[model samples]
Target: MTDSGPVLPWLVIRQDDNGNRYRVGRYATKDEAQKIADSLDDRGHKQLYWVERIGTPAL
Candidate 1:
């Protein structure tokens, strides 16, 4: 099966240990996403996640 989809790296920010996601943004590359995550980490936000698209299967 062939798959076609726009693959993007998503940055997720959490409020605390509760695992509640607060903010999310998508980037074209991992580097771009990492930059934002790094900045947020420097500011004291610990919970960060990288959600990557696995591409959607063609129908």
Candidate 2:
């Protein structure tokens, strides 16, 4: 279904050591998204976490 509602532009992405990726969550602000990613990264796991703005290049 098409979503005419507001779209969350910020995304928290997680990439594991196995080369697999997952979407941790979405937010309206970049700071909020980055905070979530930072928290997850602080856990010290094999997975890598980062924040990305939707529609932008993935890194």
Candidate 3:
């Protein structure tokens, strides 16, 4: 789904090796968030990155 609109609703999340997760940033689309995540992952750090949509219910 295309999420480019008035506001940024995508979130970039990062989790380190210890399993601590935090917010990295927000973007207008999933692609933007993924791009940042990819770049960060490529840095060779022992961390994991992923993107999530705002308002998504936590499970």
Q: Give the per-residue lDDT of model 3 (tens digit) for 3-52.
A: 75568789989998888989999998899899999999999998988899
Worst 10 residues of 1 by lDDT: 50-59
Q: Mark the regions of model 3 whose C-alpha exceeds 4 Å error after superposition.
A: 1-6
lDDT digits (tens) for residues 1-59 of candidate 1:
12766655354444566866665677677678777767776786566554443353312
Q: What TM-score do all the candidates reach, one by one?
A: 0.51, 0.85, 0.80
Off by over 4 Å in 1: 1-9, 13-15, 49-59
| lDDT ranking from best candidate downward | 2, 3, 1
TM-score for model 1?
A: 0.51
Q: TM-score winner among the candidates?
A: 2
Give the per-residue lDDT of model 2 (tens digit) for 18-54.
9998999999899999889988999989899989998
Candidate 3 collision pairs: none
Task: Report the number of clashing residue pairs per model.
Answer: 0, 0, 0
Q: Using lDDT, give the best candidate's number.
A: 2
RMSD per model, one decimal = 7.2, 2.8, 4.3
Off by over 4 Å in 2: 1-3
